[model samples]
Every structure is written in structure tokens, then in C-alpha cells.
Target: NLRFNKVVICTDADVDGYQIRTLVLTMLYRLTPTLINKGYVYIAESPLYEINTKNKTYFAYTEPEKTDILRRIDGEKYTIQRSKGLGENDPEMMWLTTMSPESRRLIKVLPTDAERTAEVFDLLLGDNLQGRKDHIAEHGAEYLDDLDVS
Candidate 1:
């Protein structure tokens, strides 16, 4: 853990991407709370789609951005490419959008509600099978299948 001063979690901008993130956070929160308390843990924001309009290139992080851009511009003239994950992005694209300090966004990990965060993490990642099942049921069907572990 001392090899690097900080840990920036880089994941896909997809459901499964966050699942992996949660698993890692669980480990960090439990085993290395110091990393989080000291603001050494971070989450990198990777845009979900890169939109190439006739005039300019745009990156959309959420559906609303894409919708807004489409409405503002002629949707027919732009190309939207879904980002599968970090692996699919070219090295330059990756550096510009995610790794670079000038344009990239990183959310530092800091638990505002430590008790609640710990409780929820335990409920989701703990050995409580019934709790996990109930939590899954409460979230609905896609919570189980929509995660992009691949």
C-alpha cells in the first residue's frame, strides 16, 4: 500500500464497473481506513460515450448529457461510441480523458457517514446471505444481471 501515495480507482462507467469498485472499497475501508481518511483514495470518472459531432467532439458522462447534446445539435450528424471500459480507449484518449491532470476528474474517497457506510458495506459484502438476498430483491432484477463483471 505504501508503494503509491494515493490509489485512484479506475473502472468502467457502467454498472459492473461500480461493482468492482465497491469490492475494492470494501477492502480499503475495512483494511486501510487511513488511506481514505487521509484523502489518498480516489475514484476516476470515465465518460460513458464519446460523441463526435460535425463541429466538435464531446464526451458524455451520463444519459442526460447525451440527450442535451443531441437536442442542441442535429443527432443525425454525430456519432456516439459507447465506452466498454478503460481497455478499449486508445492510450492518448485514455490519458486525455482520465489520466491527465488538466482534464481528468477524480473523486476523492471520504465517507461522510462512516457508520452507515460500514453498515451498508457489511450488509452487501458480509456473510449475511439473507441480507444480501433481500438487498438484491429490493433493488430489482437488473441489479443482479446488469452488472458488467466482464
Candidate 2:
């Protein structure tokens, strides 16, 4: 009997955070897929940027969202900064943006397309080196911005 009905995975909005999320999700899918299949697993969406004006602070989880926020606040003087990691965030901001059930955003991990999900996971993380190489060769350009060349 599990004590919690929902299991939420929270991480930063960066490359390392993405890797960590992938590894943990892969582990969970491999070890206890029931959690995912039962709709109990979720990923907490963290903001990538925090936009602050004189009176309001807005958190944007994606680049498009940041752009939208900026456009909405046009003509207003504001400072936009990359959001710090979970540990580095102040307690109030952390709670408001991530921990609060009312305000937080969550993506439910569903295996609705089980075969495709499995194939992609195997191609990227399994022992299919050639397949992984081929995939990157074919689709790498779509994710070039995500690569951390720095």
C-alpha cells in the first residue's frame, strides 16, 4: 500500500535537470511502470525565467512564455532574470511557483502511446547506439538550441 497517490518529479529548467528527469522517469518506467500507467506520476514544470516589475512578479516556464510576458508588459520597466534552482530559490517563491498545489503546473506522464514511447526511449537510452546516432542525425537540428555547447 502506497502512502501517496501522486508522485511529482521536480527539477531545474536546464540541461542537467532535463537529464536527471529523463533518468528518473526511465528508472520509474523500468522498475514500477504501474505508477505511470495508473496516472500517478507527474513532472512539475519549473519556470526558466522570472520577470519582475515594480509591482508584480511573473514566472515564465518557457521562452515563448517569457516573450509573451514581456510583450504583455510592454512599456513597463521590468527586469527579467533566469530563475535559480529549487534549492537557491527563496522559500516563498519556491512555494508559490512549485510547491503550491493551486498555482503549480504539472505534466502527467502517460503511456498512451506505449510502443512509440518505448521505442524512443530505447533508441535514446538503450543499447541501440546506431539507432540513437541515426535519430540524432535525422532530428538533431530541431533541438540544436537545447544543446549545451558551452
Expressed as tens digits, the lDDT of each residue in 54-130 for candidate 2 is: 99999999989999999999999999999999989999998999999999999999966333555677889789899
Clashing pairs in 2: none
lDDT of 1 by residue, 1-150 (tens): 478877898999887787688778877887888888887888999998888877788888888988887788864588888976899889999998999989998887886533356778799878999989998888767656655467
C-alpha lDDT of residue 143 in model 1: 57
| Per-residue lDDT of 149 in model 1 | 62
Runs in model 1 lying further than 4 Å from the true structure:
1-5, 113-118, 137-150
Q: Residue 75 of model 1: what lDDT?
A: 42
- State which candidate has the highest TM-score: 2
lDDT of each: 0.82, 0.88
**What lDDT score goes with residue 102 in model 2?**
100
Top candidate when judged by lDDT against the true structure: 2
